[model samples]
Target: MWSTCSLARPPKQHPYENRGCLLNDDVSNLGKVLEATKQTLFSLDTGYVSLNRILCLFEVWKTFEAKSPSGLCVLMLDVAELFNTFDISLANATQPADMERIPREIEENIGSVQLNLRLKDALVTSADHKASNRHGPGKDT
Candidate 1:
């Protein structure tokens, strides 16, 4: 029961009309369109900020050749790795017992943050992560 829908074309006054001035330009129906697009196209439901979400919006902006937010470094990470990313001497730090690939993933994350992590316990938790079998990847518990 829908009358019209065009996926291949945008409205006549699209956000591309004002390109780089999206934030400063006069808001009009395009604001509605932007909101609609945010709801449908942007995977902003969670604050995870996945690369897919960033790339999806980038693809849209690329259509307009829009610039800014430049020199961006996109990182794809497993949520678990985000738990910690700081350097600690293995001799003094408490690390979780490594599971199948958990330690490897943690190592990968280390490279991305190598320049900034100099403190110990940056990701330490109250849980007995070393050998407790309470849940999570604690020895594949």
Candidate 2:
């Protein structure tokens, strides 16, 4: 089986630590699939929603609220790890046949996949910056 070397880089905002490396190629492929999924959702007319983007939105929305909810509140969940942990049969049960090719591509490109964090980060950060920049400026609402 062919495999590619993976590197773990420390986030610029965080202090460097010698974190142990993980070598699962599927994880890399999973990242690509996640990104493609995000793009697909974004391309559709429905509001684009991704884990980090939604989290960033919630953070911003919280600032205007006077108090946290006392009763039921919506929570965003992270199920990324489920891709690596769960059986493919579980996914097969829900995934449509037309969508089978992407998973196949992911499996085929396992070792070759590159994880994309910067794009998602930029989307969230830029949206935040744009919102803040327009807040005090004499711009049409």
Candidate 3:
């Protein structure tokens, strides 16, 4: 059966050569998949994570990672350990020395007064704009 299938191809050409065309696409798409996964996980509110999300993450990781059943038990064990101790890492994260002072990078204007207030005002204005359904900067009717 396999020999007959090879007869359809031109002589001196291997049957699987055409399959290489997608290799580049597959490699590039892996990065996109990782970025989308990162965004999905990052947007989760607070510490909330569901079993469905966990399974999906695991499946995607395994698909690009192990791709075989042999290594999965250990991978699962490692993932379990990582998730189990993730809280410790988060809890140990350092806080800004002065919470009241907004860092200039995030401050509305570097070296400007009332930066915090400006940030608040910006947020309020954005909310108003969204509510009014007028797109930014001269889209108003």
Candidate 4:
């Protein structure tokens, strides 16, 4: 049995400390409290949704969806540290496949003759070399 237990009230002013204490043997109460919290937060009558709750819901859905591929192509590049080695000429000439939104927008806008001449000139002047994806320090696969 817990020798003593305390409940800190007025939660917001002491948000982190207000979690109730229970005896070690009565630890099962924590699950009940957690379920109550979930019901309160997810209750449609409350008309309030936290981003964390939304992410949790998405994560649960993702587990089921993960069994089958969504068929969307995803490319994850981690070349931020090689900024200095960028090959601007290659990037400028790149013909990106617009399977994703950002790439589609960039391809649509980057080389349009219809663009304002001043903006075109600015793009030319500001163009910087982008590093090549190949020939990194690791052993070739």
Off by over 4 Å in 4: 1-84, 87-99, 111-141
Better of 1 and 4 by lDDT: 1
Off by over 4 Å in 2: 1-95, 106-119, 139-141
lDDT of 4 by residue, 32-84 (tens): 33333211111111211211122222221222122211111112233233233
Model 2 steric clash total: 0
Worst 10 residues of 1 by lDDT: 1-10
Write model 2 residue lDDT over 12-86, tens digit each, in one string. Answer: 321222332222343335334333321111110122232223222222222112121211122223324522342
lDDT of 4 at 7: 20
User: 22-48 in candidate 3: lDDT tens per residue?
Assistant: 133433354344443321221122332
State the weakest 10-residue window (summed lDDT) of model 4.
42-51
RMSD of 2: 17.7
lDDT of 3: 0.28
Better of 2 and 4 by TM-score: 2
lDDT for each residue of candidate 1 in 1-141, tens digit (9 for 90 to 100): 111111112224434443432222222232334333312221212333322221232222221122212211122223244335322222111112212222343346443234123111211221233234456563555
Top of the candidates by TM-score:
2
